[model samples]
Target: MAVLVPYAAARPKTRLSDFLDSPERVSFSRAMLADVVDAVVDSGGNPTVLATEPVELDADATVEVDDRPLSTAVNDRLAAAADDGDDSTAVVMSDLALATPRVLSRFFDADGDLVVAPGRGGGTNALVVRHPEFRVDYHGTSYLDHLRVARDIGASVREFDSMRLSTDIDEPEDLVEVLLHTDGRARDWLLDAGFTVDVRKGRVGVRRER
Candidate 1:
């Protein structure tokens, strides 16, 4: 499945998104996007090179999906990715702190025409469509609501336990969440970058202790 992460100067932010000011946090977010991609690539049991790209890189694998607004740009890219409909595709958001290798494995196991990993707030963190045009009518929570759309299109639909998918880092609470679930590179970076990693309140912030 293919993953989609749309970013910009003031990227794809939802009202309840977890965000931070430190560049380290931002950079970690970028790295997290790649780590998640690696996990997805490894999930392929066969010879799939795994279409790879960064949220900030330039390439045909990516389209300017952030320019057209939230879901529109995403759906537009999905529409574009549809050019090659033979591959099972999964579009993942870039903000999920809990996104990990195990989560992706579960997602691959529950593959269907459409599979959505819902975020804490409205909208979704990851969207998986087995093929382009898998669903003709996509609007509203079609990302999360694809279950019904898949049925309408006679396509299979399912939602599995995922490592809470991250979309855009908007709200401060998410920063806290990121620290709790994120580890290794992101965690070390946050500590070194002077961003206090607090999860007691279930949020991440930039107030470093001492």
Candidate 2:
């Protein structure tokens, strides 16, 4: 299967700006992207990085720079894949720090013309598009919009439910999940940066050592 990993290199993980500085945010974002790409490769899928700007990464994938909005860039790839008669193409978010090969394999093997893995806060974390008419819209509540788009095109839809696949690291709170559940580069980067899980009032959060 062909996998498209969308990445914003210029200004990534803006929600974590309060916790991480500009350079650190870019580094952390690239770490998560590497982890996601590794998972996709291990799961037997070919990945292409659709980046906003040129980026240097230690991943075995092709880099394609498309400065267009997320939806437009992804749809263009989807259309091109359809024209090429590809069996199925997947759009995996670059920030899925917790994604593993097992989770991605299950998602790729799911039986559906359109398989969606919804992220926290109604975002579409990952999706496999087999229907030729299916396109993506990355606006607000994009998960719901994807489902509606699938239904309107008469494509069979399946929602793949997996905690690892659902978690995309964008906010400072999300860093906790990577530290707790992941053993990849993202987790290592956070740990090396002195981020540790802190429980306050029975709620889990991250604390960076000074």
Candidate 3:
């Protein structure tokens, strides 16, 4: 299947957005997208990046980057992928803390015209569409609200586990939960990137100033 990673917002999009509120979170978002790509490539899958930026720095031959807004550009990129006519398509978000190949494999294994996992925070975290000429009406919560649209278009539908397709990284509280699931590799990454993690040795919060 052709995997789609949509990076719609830039590093700092607007004040109303969460990731833009702090510079640290902006860097975190960028790394999160990169990690999503790493997970896909490690799974020996074809990956594409639908970026809102003009140019992509890490796009390889196996990956093609498209610059477009999430509402319009994402579908445009997927349409281009479908043009090749060689693969089914799965459109996924980039800010998942626990995105593993096994989790994604579940979606690939399902039998449906569209396999969707509802997002924890409304909308959908992942979408798998088997039909060409697939049009998107990606407005507020429409990713989940558009099941009728899929039915209207004569497409079959199925749902997957939410934990496998979560995009829960818009708040610091979410970050705290993500760190709970970070394995050795991801933990080492956090350390290497200057984010410290220390478990409480006693009934006290772990703290080390500087």
How well does each candidate superpose onto the true structure, as a TM-score?
Answer: 0.66, 0.98, 0.77
Q: Which parts of model 2 are misplaced by more than 4 Å?
A: none
List, in order, the clash count of every candidate structure.
9, 0, 0
lDDT of each: 0.54, 0.94, 0.62
Candidate 3 stretches with Cα past 4 Å from truth are: 12-22, 54-65, 184-210
Worst 10 residues of 2 by lDDT: 196-205
Tens digits of per-residue lDDT for model 2, 1-210: 899999999989889999999999999999999999999999999999999999998999999999999999999999999999998999999999989999899999999999999999999999999999999999699999999999899999999999998988877778899999999998899989999899864789899996
lDDT per residue, candidate 1, 74-120, as tens digits?
55656766785546656665555456667666775675777777655
- Among residues 3 or more apart in sequence or in different chains, the pairs in candidate 2 whose N, CA or C atoms overlap within 3 Å are none
lDDT (tens digit, per residue) of candidate 3 on 61-141 = 144455555658767765776788745788777776577777777776788878887776567777888877565666478
